[model samples]
Target chain A: MSDFIVGTCLFMCPEKERWMREREGLLHTFEVDEKTKHLKRPKADPSKIVKCFSRPAAGQLMPDTSELRPASVLLSTIRYLFTNVVTRVDYDWVMIYDFVFDRLRAIRQEVVIQRIRGPQSVQILEPIVRFHVYAGQRLCEKNISVFDTKINSQHLLECLKQLLVLYDELEEQSSMCNPNFEENIERLSIGNNRPQMEALYMLLHLGDSSALGRGISLPHKYRGKNVKLAMKISLAWFLKNYVRTLRLIQKLPLLLKFGVLSNLRLLRRDTFQIMSAAYNSKLLTFPGLKLQEILMYRDVEKLSADCKLFNLSFAYENVQFDARKFNKGLLLANPDMYFTVQTLQKYLPIILLQDDDAINDDSSS
Target chain B: MDSYIMQLRRAWLNQDGDVLADLLSLSHNHATNPQLGSDAAMTKAMEHLSAPFDDLVLHHIKVISSLNKDDALTSYAHQSAAIQSLAKILQLQKDENWMLPVMNSMCLDLRRLALKAEASKFGKNQKSGEVLEKCAECLMSCFRVCAADNRNSEDDTKRWGMLALVNQLWKVYFRINKLDLCKPLIRIIESSGLKDQFALAQKITYKFFMGRKAIFDSDYTAADEYLTYAFVRCHKESAKNKRLILTYLVPVKMLLGYMPKKSLLEKYNLLEFWELVEAVKRGNLRSLEEVMNKHEIFFISAGIYLIVEKLKLITYRNLFKKVYLVLNTHQIPVASLLAALEMHGVDDVDMDETECLVANLIYEGKIRGYISHQHKKLVISKQNPFPQLSSLNSN
Candidate 1:
């Protein structure tokens, strides 16, 4: 009996080794063939991968290892399978990624909320936060990805601000329910859990010069000239400064962010560099600055010298800034001030009427 | 005097261009050299120039005005002579057929004079506004004649002439701040089926003037519709005219919550408005004020100062959006909203005034919300806190 067992063990060892090498070969072929095959002729007929996962043989192993693998890991695994295996093999990958990512985010947020504050809070807060995030994602895809820099910046800032507000509300509600909730809530907070996304939000939605200076501290790889140009455009856009926006866009190199090969393709395709080119060629249209003036309407003449300095500081940060130099640059940059001045000159009658309080005060006195 | 009247009648009946031109020149010389003639002699000379001669003299004046060079007479001299002859013709002419042509020629002359006056430092012989008033009177008289003579009113040539005359008259009215005079003309155009008969350019011009008139009158619904119609129908190649239409249409569109495409504005050399659109979209009152001040001349000249100033309400509505974002709740506290308003330069605003402003916005259907005075809060509808300012779908 001992001699037979030794012979069997020796025989099975090579057979097992041969089986292991065959599985490795299969995985390698799967990676290469699956990628090339999917690229060549996409198939939408039900995936064989799905059959493998859904088979009863696979379900037999589930209960035994259920305790070993956490629910979150399993969820992540399923997400990976959907994004990588299922989505990659499918023809409509973009739609699949969008749908799967959106649903996954919602489920993750729901799980987090439920874990932190139970199902009751999920019903109250999940939909609002989900709506904002979904809207923000859609905005990013439609506006930002398409290089609609102006609307993209505005909507991003608004959406991020909304998210921050939701965070505060969640904090307030949880604290109200349990005074000791603060210490326990940190792990469950969406803002805390999604720090990378939060950083992106802060980086994009910066409002002031001070915030801009502080927020733009990304790693070296990401801190490129194209990125800076993008940020500068955003800042000028947020400030409602089209002159500055135009000037910045004009300064952007043709290759901007795309790789050299893609840049060549983009040049041929005329896609990536089209906006700046349009602006340079005077083909882009913008709303009148008069509307901006109305929104920012103030008695600048009434501003004290100190207040002027304060306002200047808000706009620019160079300690050695010369007002005359800046004014000269502004005037030189746009030769059409004549047209702008003429337009304003024509509306002098109505502009005078805008100061109804001053008119009424004079009459009353 | 009977001989002079008979000679003038014979010259007019024969369509004598030279005789009429010489007679106008003589009358103009007499009017200019007041010391040469007594008022009685001038009146006597005018008496010989009867209603029929008025048409003949005006025809001669049109010929003179068209002449590029006259050794002894400057263009201004010719224009003044034309105006003088026009005044005489308008004073004596009673026949509807004669009045219509006289008014048409007068409208053309006055427009030329207004353009000249605008270019010159001093109007010299005539005030542009006064000339514009004369043009308006001529347009009104044309309308009156057309109203009386239905046959002439239906005539395509006469109607086209009237449309062009009224369009020019509207520009004059705008320049002279006599927009109210356009009211009667608008009524006649609409009621008399003139609107249906307008050519494309006439249609664009009519809609533009009516749109502006509506904006001035605070009739935004009508203004939005009319301006959008004008903007859509305006030819793409006529970029300058299109920009002029957009000057008013943009603000109207914004108040109605329809933001114009930035690329569209830039293509038309209207990039100056981009900042304003951004300010209005973001509710940045400070930026709005700054942009307005920077381009004060542009907005004021566009005659959109009042319309843009009214956009402050829309700005306030945008500010409330930030409040909604920050608070992340439908029931926004009055204190927090007031703080937001204060940030936007409403420093002296109290709770009541803030609530009232909110109430006005709500009532205007801009913000779909209600003020809960008892709760010191505004309860915005969950559906759409900021209702879209929907107008006609513009191209």
Candidate 2:
């Protein structure tokens, strides 16, 4: 069955076809008996079928959402979430995130299915992708387990990929449609985010080679300072130059910085392990303040606690780094917050709706 | 036209896959007459042949004639049609992969024609690489049959055709920058346990690509392993191919602290890496920068700039090891390392960043020591402070 789907069309018997149809939720119909003037239902086949489904290869539209709300309602719902609701007094964030992510996903689904290929799609998607990143960071401050941080890196990438695809569509349409004046202006406006999206893609997939290579090749002029810094930090991460990586990441705009910090546990652990090997000394210790600064630890005590978890002993405000004492087998890195709660709340709207808000001002009117 | 039909029929009857492939050649059927492989010609070709072979003959003629008219898109279309027919024919063969030669040639041309078709669409509104991506799908259809031939005996199985298809797919993937897609296809080959059993040429091609992929993933040891296999076992006579392999093999090998011999680099005309080899060995960061900037185009184009950029770590390791050798002390001041970095024209590094540099080296076990922050000293391990990179990777 798997081979047949990807393979060229081939013949199959009706019995097998019927079996497959049964498995694929075979649609049953009522047949009218002319003589009796009554309807009869068809019988089901019990046998399993080893056959392929043949749908002619063509441009496939997304499946329809069974109960879609009107565009205005859906748009307003998202508007409420990112703007008014997110900025309201903080609530059960985990629960709120589920509600918000779902509402935004619905809007995205509606946009794609309805073929809403306009500045509106970018307006909708670009915000959603930003929310994934900033919310991912905000959730990190929750100090949940590493996986539970709601990082959702893959989902974030999916949103970004869709946003990029939309950009391509608009650019292609503008070029082919008329090369008209106003449409050209709108298309050129969307062009502003492409490099940023491209850079954001690399920051998310810091270790992915294709992403890094693509990021490096992006034209220097088009990439904004934050985008370029993100690219640079990605390269630094690539080379295991964590000091350079962390320092430059610190220089990124707050939201992009959060994106890099999401890798904090992994980076910190690897750095600890390396520092243990490099700083193998019983008498000599790395200063705690410097460690906190370079490693982005918000608290000195948590750093010592995490190091102890990794089999390193700390005392007298310095780390007793020894390679032999290091427990190489301990794979999990302790999760902690680098920013205070008040700080995170202060930047919520900006993080979630950076460029997404200005468009709303004029368009909402 | 009548004679061409006779030759194809004869090749079909004789089961001569190579001859059929040759006769199906679309590239060299140049200056075709107006009557050649026309719609009427296609009908005549199909009329002359019978079922199973008729589609094959018609597609071949159509492809050649389309090429004759310089219609790459149409040519690609007919070539794809040719492969679909080839897949049908290949499925019918039992206990032997006699038709693999036809599949191989036709698939090769399919890719070439696809690339040509994509190239001819320059300055258009269409997405670049769209044609090649679709071509990869066409190749996947053929790959599916080859991979799914589980019931066939080894001698006759279509599984042997998978590597060629995968190699073709890799080119498409790499060209389109879709490196991640190579993962699944790799799993199929690895699980099949036919790593070394395929033809030597195909194996070389496979290993070379896998080597480059490993480099991109930053797995230098695996990259070294694969590329060395291709480099040493690869035929020396194929200078062009060996030169190509060396493009990746050189930087990857250097990262593991093994420099290429001058004669070999000269032989391959890859002496650009030689100056790089010297700078890294001497811990001369300034010269390294110069060499890199001079050959920026070559290195970046080869996608080795990043990998070579990694060589800077090893350079630091080398430079610091020198400071250790001259001072010959377990405790070396951070100031000494700073001076060494400055001497080597590493202008941008400061004290904290210097410690970070040593921190990475110590972390990697290239050096066995730690930095004492208050005292501003780097404490070195007495036992093999600078271990050979090759030895470190071995452990």
lDDT by residue (B1-395, candidate 1, tens digit) is 34443555676666563554444453333224433233343355366666545444444434343432321224444455555555454444333233344444445655665455444524143333554565466455655544544453354234444576678878888777667677777777788665676678877888889898887776777897898898888888988888888888888888777888989988888988899989888888888888878987677666666567667778887898888998899989988988987887657566755654675566456677565544677778899777666732231
Chain A TM-score, structure 2: 0.72
TM-scores of the candidates, chain A only:
0.27, 0.72
Worst 10 residues of 2 chain B by lDDT: B25-34
Compared to the true structure, candidate 1 yields what TM-score?
0.42
User: Least lDDT summed over 10 consecutive residues: which range in candidate 1 chain B?
Assistant: B65-74
Question: lDDT of all the models against the reference?
Answer: 0.48, 0.75
Looking only at chain B, model 2 earns a TM-score of 0.95
- What is the per-candidate TM-score for chain B? 0.73, 0.95
Q: Runs in model 2 with CA error above 4 Å?
A: A1-77, A90-95, A143-147, A167-178, A355-365, B28-34, B123-125
RMSD of each: 31.4, 11.0
Query: Which candidate leads the pack in DockQ?
Result: 2
